[model samples]
Target: MIGLVLAAGAGRRLRPYTDTLPKALVPVDPAGEGTTTVLDLTLGNFAEVGLKDAAIVVGYRSEAVVERQAALEKKYGVKLHLVHNDKAEEWNNAYSLWCARDVIAEGVILANGDTVHPVSVERSLLDARGNGQQIILALDTVKTLADEEMKVVADPAKGVRRITKLMDPAAASGEYIGVTLIEPTAAAPLADALKATYERDPQLYYEDGYQELVDRGFQVDTAAIGTVSWVEIDNHDDLNRAREIACQY
Candidate 1:
């Protein structure tokens, strides 16, 4: 299986830092031994989980990643593959993921480039393998629900029944933490679902693609990372939290 990261979005909320570099390259660790990017921690987690190869979908200052390609591979001990998203700046991540459909066939532990989580989360997903679930999402059921969070409503017998940001916070079972294990059997269908999502609305998030799958009767299960400290770096506040959490790892 290959590790996949969707690093295409132009994080507009993050200004000057994202002006020259993509959000994935934004340094989450400034006072450490050296600079540590969000992508660094992500690739590190993948390597820790025994994934030797990874594909990163890049856009909006893709050159930043191009320059660090070799160093990141050397640091993480993983072969890096770059997948370009032509419409990255024009659309949301639903299309960004669809751009990597070719590598999806290899089976992937896909993570968002903007999230900083521990290796334990990756291990949880990897450990849940062979359970007959094609798609396994790393969920944080312990976290308090919020309106901005991508909420999930899961059924014990049917797995993930719904996933979206518009759902009522009171009805959500947990937050989908941008990490997912997509087996080879589910990749093709997932890619198709993603295509349909972007075709309908370019602003739709990749989580919407999972909802499409759930609507089609695909079972998307979850592996809970209980009380783990992780943050999705969307704005300045999230970046600060990411720095604190990243230091612990």
Candidate 2:
């Protein structure tokens, strides 16, 4: 199985901080002598999960990010491949993910570059492979769901039956922890659906493609990661909070 780190976004919410540097390179905790960048932390976590071969989809000052990650590969002996997204700003994360579609096989873990989580996504990947499911998104029921965060709606069985299109500040109950374990065999069909949707309605969110599969009776299960700490850097406020979490470990 291969691990894909999606770091191609322009990070509009992060503003001036991401103006010069990619969000993955932003230092999460600087108080300690051995402070690590979000990218480094993610790599460390992936290493812990026993995922040594990885690829990063980069954009928005990709040269700098590539250089830093190259040094990391040399220092850690991890295979870090960089795939550039030339039009990252025009597209959403799903499109960025498509940039690396050729490399990702049937058993692959798709992770957001700006995320750090306590749980190893390796187990989720294993579960998906063993089950031979089309898709399995790692979900955590947050105590408080914020207005701007991505939310999920599951069935009474606690499975993610639908990813809601309605974006309301009051309708959310669960938050996605930036880890989506995808089956490579489902990639072709899923990507085809996404292409059709994107061509017809460019404004539609990427998850709409997944929902289409769900609506068609494809088994897109929700694997719950109970009591795990995870953070996705969206803005400066999130950065500060992630810094606190980083210091705890």
Candidate 3:
């Protein structure tokens, strides 16, 4: 499977750094030598998990990634394919993911570019794959639920019943940690679902696309990444948490 990352957001909250780089480029590892990004670790993780070919959907300061493409490729030993999202500045990640639908058929291990997690997370998804399951999301069943988290109500046999941030925190089974395994079989429908999601609302997240799948009677599965030290860097506090654990990865 190929590695797919959605790294197009401008990360308005990240200011100065994101002023010139995408959210994925914000530095999370304080001790990491010359490493200025979560994408660096993400590519490294992909290589570690045996994904040599990867695609990154980029927009908003995308040139920064182009300038570092060769160096990133050489450093991680993974071939980088960039999928450009022209609407990145004007839209959310549903569009960013849809921008890479062409590669979804290759079977993908997709990770949100703004998240900082270890290679073990990818390894877990790889191990949990199959059993006729078409799509698998990395769920953090251990984390405490909050209003901001992308929550889910999953059934052991019925798969994900719902996936969205608007749901009540108390009713959620877990939080979607922004990693997914999309098999080739799920590609066409998922691409269609994402397309419909973005067209319905430009501001909607890709998780909303998963909701559309659930709405369409598709069985979207989940794999719990148990008690892993990971963080989605949405603001300064999250960036601090990421730095604390990124070096360990």
Candidate 4:
């Protein structure tokens, strides 16, 4: 499976830092003797898991990635394919993902570009492969649930029951860490589901597309990544936390 990163969001919350750069390009840590952005860590994780190629959905500040593409490829030893999303600033990630419909058939391990987590999270997803699992997610069952988290509820005997960011924190089973393994067979259906999702509401997130899949009888499973230090950088505070935890990896 190839690595896929949804890096198109214009994280307006990260003001000056995001003025000319996308959220994925926001510097968060100093690793390997260089100031590494969130995208660097994500691509590094993919390489650690033996995924030699990755497609990153870019927009908002697409030229920044284009300028650094060769260096990023050389650093991670992973070929970079930039997937441009024309509507990244106008629409949400549900539409951004639909922009990558062509590469879905390659069976991708999708990671949100803004999340800073260890390679263990990706390893957990890869380890849970087979057994007919079509859509597998990396879940943080150990994290303290909060309103801002992208939460989930699941059935142990079945699979994910629901996924949304607007749910009651008390009712959630865990938080989705924005990493997913989409099996080859599930690609076309997922693409169609994503299309229907964005068409229904252009502002919806890609997680909403997973909800659409579940609503249509698709089984979306989860892999618990026990305890891990991970953060989704949306603002200055999150960037601070990311720097603290990312160095541990």
Candidate 5:
């Protein structure tokens, strides 16, 4: 399986910093050994988990990633493949992930470019691979649920019953932390779901694609990343929290 990262979002809320760079390139560890982009942390985690081959979907000032590709490869010790998302700035990540269908067909530990989490999250997913779930998500069951978070409701016997950002916070069991393990059997269906999701609504998130798969009778499971420090960098506050937590790794 390869490591797949969705790094195409424009992150309009993070202006100035995102003016010339994609959100994945935004520095989270400013005071570390050198600058550390969210992509850096992601690739590093994947490498640590022995996923040496990785594919990154890029758009919205994608030149920045092209320029840094070699350096990032050298730094993380992983082979990097680039997938272009033509509608990155125009559509949401459902399309961004679908753009990588060709590369991730074998299988993938898919991560969002904007999230910062430790290698433990990757390890948990890998360790649980024997559980035989087709698609497994890294969920933060310990965190407080909020409306903006991608929430999930799991059935003890059936696995994930629902996953979405629109679910009522009071009813959610946990938040999906943008990390997923998609086995080969589920990749094609996931790509189809993602395609259908984007076709239905360009603004919908890739989580909606998971909802589609679940609705189609696929069992999407979850692995709890208990009390792990992580943040999804969406705005200034999230970036600050990422900076604080990223250095801990």
Candidate 6:
């Protein structure tokens, strides 16, 4: 499966630190706890999952991102595919997804560059592929989920049916982790929906397009990922938690 790393966010909250570089380029050490850098760990984790052919969707100081990724590819010996999104600063994660639409034609795994997730989660997502299922978003039922984290409402029984998207912090039952698996068939529909939304409202997030697919009849499964070590680092607190968790590996 192809691995698509969304490494384009500007990380506005990260301020001065991010003023010079993308958040994904921030250091994260798996062995030393938040000491290494997120970009290294993210790429290394993908390699550990048996993913060799990987793509990184970059924007917002993409030059730095490209240089870093190139160095990583050489050091790790993993094939790296670079795709650029000029409007990364204007759009959401969905725009990054759109940039990689053509390059990825089969089953692929999607991950955010600024997050550290359990290695097993990536494997489970790739294993959950089936017919007519274009995307399988990894989710876990946590006691407290922040508003910044992506949340979703899923069916109680099937565990595969996703009812709706939840961005409001107060009205959420589960938090979506950083990674998702997508099949080739679901790309075009998602892309088309996104284009329509972009034309209508350029500020819409990528989830809007996913919701559009759901509204137009698409089966995007929600794979339950319970009790996993998944953390998305966007601020100092998240970085602290990432450091604590990284040491456990």
Model 1 clashing residue pairs (backbone): none
Give the clashing residue pairs of candidate 3, or none.
none
C-alpha TM-scores of all predictions: 0.97, 0.86, 0.98, 0.97, 0.97, 0.87
Model 2, CA-based lDDT: 0.70
How well is each residue in 92-202 modelled by candidate 3, as lDDT tens digits? Answer: 899889999989999999999999998888988999875999999999999999899999999999899998888899999999999999999999999999999999999
lDDT of 1 by residue, 104-171 (tens): 99999999999999999988988888869999999999988889999999887789988998989899
The models' CA-based lDDT, in order, is 0.91, 0.70, 0.91, 0.90, 0.90, 0.73
Instruction: State residue 247's C-alpha deviation in candidate 4, in Å.
Output: 1.3
The list of candidate 5 runs beyond 4 A from truth reads: 32-34
For candidate 1, give the lDDT. Answer: 0.91
* Global local distance difference test of model 6: 0.73
lDDT-superior candidate, 5 or 6: 5
Kindly report the root-mean-square deviation of model 6 from the true structure over all alpha carbons.
Answer: 2.8
lDDT of 2 by residue, 1-249 (tens): 667787777676887767876777777875623347777777776676677778889988787676687678865556888988876767666566666777566456777878877645546545545655566777776546666667787774535666753666366547677777777787777777666656666555567767766766666767767666678887888888888888765
lDDT of 6 by residue, 1-249 (tens): 778888888887777667877888765564533246677776677788887888888898788867666678876667888898998888776667777888656557888887777777776776666544578877777647765666776664434333234456566657777677878777788788777766667776666666677777776677767677768887877877877776665
Candidate 1 lDDT for residue 14 = 83
Model 4 accuracy (lDDT, Cα): 0.90
